[model samples]
Target: MPYSRRAAVYDVEYTEERDVGFILGLVGQAAPSVLEVPCGAGRLSLRIAPYAGRLTVVDLEPEMVARTVAALEREGHGGRIRGRVADMRELRLEERFDLALIPREALQLLPPEEGRQALAAAAAHVAPGGRLAVDLATFLPVPGGAPDPDYYDPARTDGVWATDWIRTLSDGSQLVRQSAQHHDGMSIRFDLQYRVLQGGRVAEDWAAGMRLHRYSRGWIDDARPDGMAVEAVHGDYDGSDFTGDSPRLIALYRRGPAAGR
Candidate 1:
């Protein structure tokens, strides 16, 4: 998901949740210098600026980076933020940060190999004794059977709630469409689709499929790169201990004594 094409609708489609603030607080407590990879639309960056001594954010999409810069300028934090367009797997910076964050399950978007590469790249930029934090979702069974239209209307802006929800299959892929109208004459719509392939053919298809890689504490701890250690894993933004039943996995890692420049 390049996400650049949908940059305009991204912010509205996915509103900030409580977890964002939780992550921001954790980052603020960990360090004053922060590095945020895949900082989409500057949503979290804006919140991080006031508490951070210096903030550096990067995204693979130029449009997203531009939006972040624009947002920073609008919020008067442009002077303190350094926004760049770069791939996390290939990131190379002369400076190190006291804290590095890959929030919003951005790591889950990549395949396992690419995800590892990105993690290593992120860890490389962490200053010794510093920290790296990543947010990921644990694998859960698809809502048990058929999708319910009413379940999709989790957000509403006025008297009108989301409706006309439908799911369809096309060329071995499934597509889901839903829309809602706001009181300000504006409307929000989402079209999500994905397919699972096997032997060059589609084996399964699902609507609203996130195509995310499910992560666990064991997996993260096992995948830690040299010079970095998994420090803690939380089930939520409130610093709860991660468990098999936890809905979210927020993993924090600390750089080893010999790590980074």
Candidate 2:
């Protein structure tokens, strides 16, 4: 229910996102193959298409897969991309990639146990000596990760605070997205709503929800399969050194020979 309904208007709601510079840099000028887990409307996939010799995008939503493949085709990269509607936890592709990334804090969206399994499933497809990059939202509306006062209003326990994004579409309709979240001791749960306005009146309404669990900073170290080790960790997308003051915990893991097929 989270992304299934949102896929209808996801592009209009999140079109301004331009945070792929670091991800592109990591992919470099070219890569033999690239695997994108949950290719949310192809935002990052479109950016990485040129550098990828071959791209395999997997997502749990069929609508998302269709949108991503359609975007790539529009960009003339359809022949080089494969879109699969599959759950990351049960994904067992026959092929491996030079780079496999679970971007935009997506891994955290799963329950802790499923998150680990999903990660392991991804790691299983990582070519020997290949790279696995995961972007983590370690510090959010929490105390340890430098919480933003404006973003988190502890006044509401049922729902701490809501962040809204409003955008105008080409057809003159205004789309408003409100994402409200709260920490439920174990995970941060989110409730999302989308409102479409036309002629100064609400025309349509849609809703979705998902959870992002808080993982220990070192959880990846333990969750990663054998023969994989942390190669690098960056604070943010700018490739800055990770620090306590950093707002994000982006990590890169390398799979070695011991990591079997």
Candidate 3:
């Protein structure tokens, strides 16, 4: 995702609609020090700034970090916000946090192995009795899978959530073609395109493409790494108990004292 353009308009595009009130309420109850990975625009950080004892906001893009820093400065909370540009898989924070968050399915952007690595990294940062929270987007299979929207109704979904994409690549022996999406409101107008290549030659062209992941309870059960223990899983931000078919996977994992070297 080329985010330079998005970085400029990110706040207007999403900050207001981020549901910080709900997140803050959760943070208040948890009262956990936080390290928010991929903390885009620092919207959540700023919202939870006063409540958290310490916060370290990180993003892969420098511009995003700059934008978040600017927002923090504008809000007079620059002293409380520590902004950095770091890869989720290669996290390098020295201090342990009571809570480490990877919200908005930021984990989905990584390959499965990287996701596991991040889980380990996050676990390494959790102090004894600390918790780790992350969201999974049950919306679609990631990396190389198409979205299936038969379960969703655009008119009733309530929000400007939608997606569409196309990809075409034909090699002499291998052919790859896919078009998938779920569009709503103004999303219908946005489309992504890709170039098709075959045997290193131009074969054709293609065009292409979460709510909290709608992972099942079993999925969460399976996500437990070796050193973490599952505390509770929520279906949504409201703290509903996770069901097997829940549309969102809100998970909290605690790092056992045995974890970490």
Which tens-of-lDDT digit does each residue in 18-72 have in candidate 3? 3465567667766557888888877677777888877888888898899888877
- Sort by lDDT, top down from the best: 2, 1, 3
Q: Write the per-residue lDDT of candidate 1 for residues 1-261, one digit (tens) a residue.
A: 545545644554445466677867776686889999998887788888888888999998899888888888898887778988899999998879999999867887776678889999998898988999988765332244222122233244534534343333334433333443322212223345434444456665444423445455677877787798888888766788987766578888898888532
Clash counts per candidate, in order, are: 0, 0, 11
User: What lDDT does each candidate get?
Assistant: 0.70, 0.78, 0.63
Question: What is the C-alpha local distance difference test score of candidate 1?
Answer: 0.70
Show where candidate 3 strays beyond 4 Å. 15-19, 30-32, 140-219
Among these predictions, the greatest lDDT belongs to 2
True-vs-predicted CA distance for residue 192, candidate 2, Å: 1.7
Backbone-clash count (model 2): 0
**Poorest lDDT segment (10 consecutive residues) of candidate 2:** 145-154
Estimate the TM-score for candidate 2: 0.88
Worst 10 residues of 1 by lDDT: 180-189
Best by TM-score: 2
